[model samples]
Structures are given as structure tokens and as C-alpha cells.
Target: MQHLLSRSWTFFIGLATGMMLTLAGSGLASKPQDSPAFQDAARIYSILQQIREFYVDEVAYDALVDDAISAIVSHLDRHSDYLDRNEFAHLTDVTSGEYAGVGMELAITEQEVTIVNLFPGSPALEAGVVAGDRVISVDGQLLADSDAETLLMGMRGPAGSLMHLTVQREGEPELLNFALERRQIDVKSVSQRMLNDATAYLKINSFTQTTPQEVATALKELALAPQLSGLILDLRDNPGGLLDSALEVADLFLDEGVIVKTRGRYYEANVIYFANTGEKISGISIAVLINGRSASAAEIVAGALQGNRRATVFGEQSFGKGSIQSLFPVQPGEGVLKLTTAHYFTPDGLAIDGKGITPDRFVPSQVVLESLLTPIINPLPLNTVVAYQGEKKIQIANQDNQLRTALQALDHPD
Candidate 1:
């Protein structure tokens, strides 16, 4: 999948031409040589050329240039990345909240590709793929030591194409192979259902550009249910997307409260986002589900709900990623830089850097539900209740256990 820059000089030249055209179209004259802006651009170009020609190893010039562009932006902060034309288009598709794929979220772990999450009703999920399963190979090619990005790219293809994957699951004697056909994955950001004909269950996968609208639609549907008792907002294994989307989603449930705030080196980056008037589900008990994989914008929503006591967070601690990245168009066509512009905080002013949103109840990954059941003679004909005694009270029986637990908790809130 690696393309050599020298071999693609035509592409590079075209990219450079496009950048020049964009600059010209802007109608802004080049700054004088004495200007700091001009000098900085010149210096960056010089470094890029030097590394391209004189780097000790045979580096991919295109990748080197992209990395150089990214390095410069990194000094600004963490959210930014250098994206070429293809990368930019792919990014756009993700934010658009729809694309064609097998419908699984993947991550690199210990140099092996792992299934981080599976979209409900996705082909992958229907094929019996589950989180924590290590992908051993793709299309019969060994994927050991391969980067997650590369592995994912290889697995993705046009609709109607097929991808073969070999996976290694924990405590399994044989490797599992699955043949998945590519299809358009319309990412459903929001899904709602009544947990027990009273409590509503809403699961938000990520906060994409359309997330706010999707959440609103789901909320409106759930609100139609009569005598709603409670709500379960599941953010488990959700990696954040759009910040604004997260803010809007929080606003749907919160009434007149600070959702989240951002703080950075610059004063301008320090600002607070507040929930406006109007509560979609006011005066309803709420419980939020989060895990170590819940990060970024997910943390924002969970933190806001927890801080305002709007919801009681349950499950393991969340992934501590509080930094906000702002995309800056550095050199259009050549690449764009994503920079970490700010650090976000909860409504109660709790920092979320290394400290993720701690759940009100800590549920561990072991201890089966069988241990929670108590023998009852003539058990009362009432809804059963189970609470996590400690970290080891719950067990990871399967990939669906987390969701099952969340549903159970919402049904019988202690």
C-alpha cells in the first residue's frame, strides 16, 4: 500500500500546481520576504527538500513531506494531521456519517489489528465478529506487525467486493476465518428502544456532523413512548468525532447548564459550551454507560451528564483523551495540518486529560452473572435487580455483556 513519492512525481507536481492555483484564487499577494510568514514557509520548504534528498535512509519522499507538515502542526497542538487528497476525502466521508464498509471499528493493539467495536446489525456483527478479537490476517495475507490504518485500508473495498479475515480469539484453539462482503455502511449514530416498555435505551456510536440531527430524531421517537421511566445513554467503546455534535447531543438532555469547556495556551481557546433552554427528556432518570474505549467527544457528553447529575455513569473508567484538535489548511492539495488546539473540561470544571470520567459504579471484566443470582423461595413477581458488588462483580461472558448489563441496570436502578 506504500507509494513511492519519486515514482509519483506527476502526482506531486499536480498537487503543487493545485496549491499554487488555490493561493492565486485567494487574490492575496505573497507577503514580502521580510515577513515572518514568508520566512517560515521558506524555512519549512527548505527542511522538506533537505530531508527528501539527504535523509540517511531511503525514505518515501511523499510520506516524509507529509510527516514534516504534520510535525510543524504538532507543535501547535494534538488534533491535527497531514492529509493528502485521498486522506481528506476519506475524512470527509467519515464525518458525513455514512460510507461503504463491513461496519466495524478497528484499532491497533500490540502491533496486531483488533476489533474495537462492532456496529449493531452490521455485516461484521452478523458474521459473528466481536470486539477484542485479534485479526490475524486479511485476504490471506499475514497482518502481524502491521499498522491498524494499513490493515483497515486493506480490508476496505468497493461494494460487492469480498474481504477474507482470519481472527484469533482469546481461549480458542483454532483461528476463525470470515469472508465479509463489502457494502455501504450507513452509520446509524443513534438508536433508541424502550428498555422495558418504560425506560428508554439510546446508544450513540460517535458524534459525527449529522449526529445532532440523528440524536434529535431518536429522542423525538423515544419521547412518544408513554410514561417513560428512565434513559440509558450508552457511550461504550465510542471514539469521539465532531465537538459541536457532542455539544448539541448533550444540550438535548441537559437544561441550562454548562456542557463542557476548553482551555489552551491561548486565551481565545478557553471557552465554555452551555446547554440552551428546552429539555427533550426532562425529569427522567438517566444512566450513562462508558468504558475505557469511550474517548474525546464521548467523554464530553459523559462528563457533562455526570457532572450535572443528569445521569449516573456506570462501567469501567473511560479512555482519557481530553485534547481538542483543530484542522488548519496549511498547504491545500499538498496536505492539511490537524493541531491540538485545546484541552476540554467537564461542566463541574474537572480536567479530562489523564483522568477520564469515572463511573459511579465500577464494573470489572470478570465475575459472571450467575454469581449475582440469589436463590429465592417464592420469588416476588417483580423486576429483578442486580448491582455490581465490586470491580469483580460482573464478567465479560461475551461481547454483548456490557450492553446487557447497562440494560439491566437501567431496569432496576438502585
Candidate 2:
């Protein structure tokens, strides 16, 4: 569905209003408008007037204008969009990495809204919400027909607000219910743990505003452990977020080089991001893991590191999403136009728009890894109950093939 708000919308409204005022003051026999700008404006103004005066039924003029404005931007590209007030607010919350909600990431799976991830220290995680749980309803409202945005809007609200949630879990005979309180959730994008005595693992969910700092903190904490010789940077399933966050995260392990470059028609969009003089974690081999779901900023990081010979990327080809979206706020507290502005390139000047980063070593199947596991740990838990942090690391290492391969590569670097 098309939404409303654009930078051009303000100028459009002004032009239409001016034309209407002029038309009202002057007679119908006034000379035809000579200027091409005036001619186009008059044509649009006439149509709007016709709709208001002769349409089959009465329609909200502002709503009609909003829709018209949205229609104008929708033709540009799939990524460019006009965000209405509510959507603009949601975008703000996402980029800022703070919102009042139960703090679970939801995805559409088999035509149902399913829980995919839970932020640490979140109400949903504490309430025993696990991945693969399908949402049935929120506060007694069924979500069979609700889109992800609608479901998110239903889930989020004022802090301290109470909400009832219903979900269907795998291997469970009955549906589960939880009374959850919406709290101010500060999303932690970087999750890190020591894979072994010598290897550190970092999983970046998305490149949020606070992600760079969170990554730095994780590296520092991991550094405290003895013999941290290797680092596994996991970007699998990361859909990417803020571009600056991605650049900073890539810079953390790089020492003086072009991290990534962007090129577009606009001069502001055509620029290169360079790493500073020093690396935070030196003398450590880095392994970056990516899959088909990894995209945008995640690809930027992988490309930068791969181009610089700083890390070996592992797994399937990444999601090719390199176009940049620049948000133009149309009105205060109203909405914004998310316009596609630029295309991203790796440090080596390889464009990543449609061509994703190819992994250095591609492992075709997780099933193969499953077969290789010892019988003692066979039959991994179908629905993992949140285990102790230490046990969780072991489970993660055993369950993911890409991570296991990266760990092996880092441990026995040739």
C-alpha cells in the first residue's frame, strides 16, 4: 500500500494553493498560462478541483493529496518510498535503536508472523519466547491478515503498557499465552562470546546506530580473555541498517585503507569511507561469515575486509543490496521521503548493487555438517530453550556449519 509524505509535496501544495487563489480572483476568460511550470501546475490543480466538485462521492481533499504525492514517488524505484506519520515514527525508532515493545524480531514464515530473534534482556526473551514460535494474536486481536508493519505497530506502545500475546510453538500440543509489559528496549545489535579459549565470536544482527560502539565493547571484553588469537565476525541473516555503523564496524579491525566507496548522481552520495591509522584488535586472524540473507551494510563490511585481505569470508553468496536510501523529512512530525540516492562499492572499487560478495570458501549444506557431528551430540534440540550463556556458545558453535568452518580456518591458519 502506498503511504504519504515527500519533500516535493510541500512545494506541490504551495503551487496548487497559489494557482487556486489566482484562479478564484481572475475570470475564466484569463489568458492561457504561458510558463510550462504554470501549465503543468494548472493541469494538476484542475484535476483536483474536478475531483472535489464532481467526483461520485465526497472525499477528503488532504487524503487525496497525500495519495497523489505518494503515487508520484512510487514510480521512482522499489526502495524509494513516502513514509506516512506512523511509518516515519517507526523508522525513527528503528534507526535510533530504542522503542517501547516486548523486544522480539518477527518474520513472515509460511504466511504467519513468527518470532525469529529476541534482544538480550528483553521482556519477550524473559517470558520464554523462542525462535520459530508463530504469533496468533496480540491483545485478543487475530493477526492472520495483518502485515509485518501492522503486527509491529500492534506490538509496540507506551512504556509500562500491558499486552497479552498468544503464540503456537513447535512440538507443543497447546497454544501458549503470555502477559507482557512493554518496556523501553535498547536493542543490542552486537552479540559476542568466546568460541573457545583462543577464538572469539561476534554476531552482528544489524548495523544499528549503537552497533559500532557495541562491537568495540565486545572486542574489548573478548580481549580480556587469555589468548584471543582469532575472531569470527558473523553477518549471516543481517539485513543491514545504518551505513555509518557498518563503516565503523569495518574500521574496527582495519588499519588505514579505503573501507568502502559510494557513487551516485549527488555529490554527497559519491564519497569514500576510509579506516583510521590503527586497528583495535591486531595480530588476530579474522573470519567473516555471510549467507544469502546478508545484505547492504553487511556486504560493505565483508567487501572491505575481503578487499583489504583482513578477513576470509565464508558461506553462500550474500544478498545484493547496495543502493542507499536517503530520508528527506517532508514535514515535522508528519513523515519523510526515503529516496534511493547511491550505490555502494568495495574498497577495491567493485560495485555491489546486484552482484553480491562471493564467499572465499562455500560450504553447500548444513546437512553435511550435521552428518559429521558425533553421535554423542546428535539430534540437536528442535526448539532451543535459552540456556546459560556459556552453554549457549557451545550450542551455537555446534549448530552452525559456517561458524564451525570459520572457527576451524581461524584456529589453523596456513
Candidate 3:
């Protein structure tokens, strides 16, 4: 009881003083100590003290402090959050592009955890767990009502830990069961494939610490230096990641120009990023594909490329999440506070906070391609899916109209 009261008093006193200083800094220095802001601060402390002393049941002081901090920070914006220890760890794992898990990219579809993609050489891939599989449970825990964060926490653990997964695959007679061992899953941020002899298609899942390097390496592997005619950079369904990674990726395509700018109350936040000299692959016509899911760092790259006329953006308007979040560590071994620090602007000086970036050409969702092209008889075999439009045949994993249109545009540039 003594320890709790003493700590609580200290916390409330410090909080009251901080509030007063903030009020003073905001041109209210001449106000009396009994001002509304001061009274509110005192009221908060009094309420907390009362709750601690006279509550119906025992309460955790740490939980109360955490809840107070969360309430204060989260009300600022939708992007800001008070990350708990687990949430902070998850953020680190994502930005680092590495974690101990089965290595399956998952999405919530109709309240079920569905596999979207798999990393190469991952435990999930080796176990024949393909995309479109729905994970019903993890280690005997039913994930029916779990959100993304809970699903991730349940999946990830110490390396070499054994895990069991129950999955529901389409056309399966019964639910598939698999026993897998957790391993270090190094997610590839960038994946590439050739659209044709001269065109290359690169899909970026998310920006991470290794994103720029992965992109550079993919370009090198394409070996299209002398013969490269066109490039398609796909940011479809990407939720975005680190801002620095986005800047570096944009730098690879731009010779020299202002990539993006940020504005905030602090001078440190108000800065501009400029591309360095030279392009990684010069003189190649570029097409960028974005959708409603593309945001933050993803939008940054698309806006930079589009504004500089280095690439033509297609598909749809990007997700408007242009606010910058900076992590402030609360204390050692505690959690961090993710605060919205600034609003970012495109190279054209346009803010995309609420209004997203409009594409140069709007392309609708997947199409049958029957009206636009002449139907040809399947020469390979039955049950083989192939994307064909007009006289050109583009081999794709799936029938994506945006990609098909982008390829056509790049093939015959306007």
C-alpha cells in the first residue's frame, strides 16, 4: 500500500507539472494555477488516487498507468497507438522482415485467417501449405475470433518450437493437419519475374530494412541492363513499412529530385528527401501498379515516381495513410508509444492524408478479357490457366487486369 501510494503520488505530481508546462508553452503562461487545464490535471490525479484507494476490487497500478497513457496517445489520431510489449515486438519483427514462425503471409477473409503468400524455403512451403489455405487453429487454440495481432502472436515463438496447424483448403474432403517446426523466417520484401524478353515485373510486399537491397539485387538478377525495355513495379495490396526504405527504393529509379517532404510542429520532422544522382536502370519505361491497400511508404514511392514522370501509376487510388509515426520508448522493458509526428507530402507538394493519389490511368479489377481480345484455343492442355488478351499472351500466376493493362501500355508506350 505504501509503495503504491508513493509511486502514484510521484506520477501524478510529475504529470501535473508537465501539463502546466505544456499549457505555459502554448501561450497560456499568464494563466493562474486554478485554470481549467490545471484543474483537469488535478482531477485526473485525484480520480486515479481514488480508484486506487477506494475501488471495489484490487487493481494493478501498472495497468492503470498504461491505460491512462494509451487513452492520452490513441485519442490523438487513428495512426497513433500505445504499443504494449507484444505489439512493440511485433512491429520490430515486421520492420526487420524476420521472425520465428512457419513463414506464411496471412490475411483475414470473412473472419478467418487465410494464407496469402509463403516465403521461399519456409516451413509452411515445405509442408505443402499453399496459398488459399485457411488456418482454423494453431496449436489447439481456435482462431475463429482472433484478429491479426492475436494470430501473429499465436504463430510466432522461439525458433525450433513445434507447432500444429489445422487448415481448410478448397476442394479438400477434410481439414488438413500439419505438424511444423518454427524457424527463422526471413521474408523477402521484393519478388521479381520477367513479363517478357524485355519487360520485368517486380512485386513489393512491404518496405523493410532490407527492401532497398532486395530490390537492387532483383534488378541485377533480371540481367536486363542492355536489353531492358520496360519495368513494372507492383505495389498492389502492400500496407507499406519504413519511410527510409521507401526513400531508398524511390532513389533507385530517380536520377535526382525531391522525393517526398514531411511537415510537423518540430523542426526535426519538417524535412525533405531528395534522390541521389544516377538511376539503377536508365532509359527503361516504368509502370507502377497500386491499389487501395497501398499506403504510407508504398504511396511515397508511387507518388515520387509518378510526380517525377519516371513511372506511370496505374490501378487505383492509394490508401491515404500519409501520417508519420515515431516510436518513443516509454521505459526499459516496458512498451513504446507510437505517436503520429508529422504529415507527409508527395513530390508535387500534395498531401495525401485523407485524399489518396490518383493514378495516371484508372484500371478496374480483374476482367475476363473476352471483349478486348480474340479467344484462342488452349494449345498446352486442359486445366491450365493462362492470361491472354488481343494477340499477345502474358503468362501470369493469376488473371490480373491491372497488370495486363500495364504490360500493354509498356509494350506500346504512348
* Cα lDDT of model 2 by residue, 1-414, tens digit: 111111111110001000000001111244467977679768888999999999999999988977887788868965676767776666557656777777776544336665656778888889998866888988888877664445556666788888898999997999999998888888777888887899998998766668899999999999998788999899876766677778788999999899988787956667888999889999889999988767777888899999999999999998777777776666666666667777778888887777789989996425322221324333223322222454432222225666767877887888
Q: Report the C-alpha displacement of residue 258, candidate 2, in angstroms.
A: 1.9
Q: Model 2: runs farther than 4 Å from truth?
A: 1-42, 53-56, 107-115, 132-151, 162-179, 368-398
RMSD of each: 8.5, 9.7, 9.7
TM-score, per-candidate, Cα-based: 0.78, 0.77, 0.76
Clashes of each: 8, 0, 0
- Tell me the TM-score of model 3: 0.76
**Alpha-carbon shift of residue 256 in model 1 (angstroms):** 0.8
What residue runs in model 1 are displaced by over 4 Å at the alpha carbon? 1-32, 35-44, 47-64, 70-80, 109-112, 369-414
Sliding window of 10 residues with minimal summed lDDT for model 1: 5-14
Candidate 2: deviation at residue 390, Å? 35
lDDT of candidate 3 at residue 360, scale 0 to 100: 96
Per-residue CA lDDT of model 1 for 226-331, tens digit only, reads: 8887888988867676677787899998988899988878666688888999988887888888888777778888999889888888889987778765545545
Instruction: Report how far residue 259 has shifted in candidate 3, in Å.
Output: 0.8
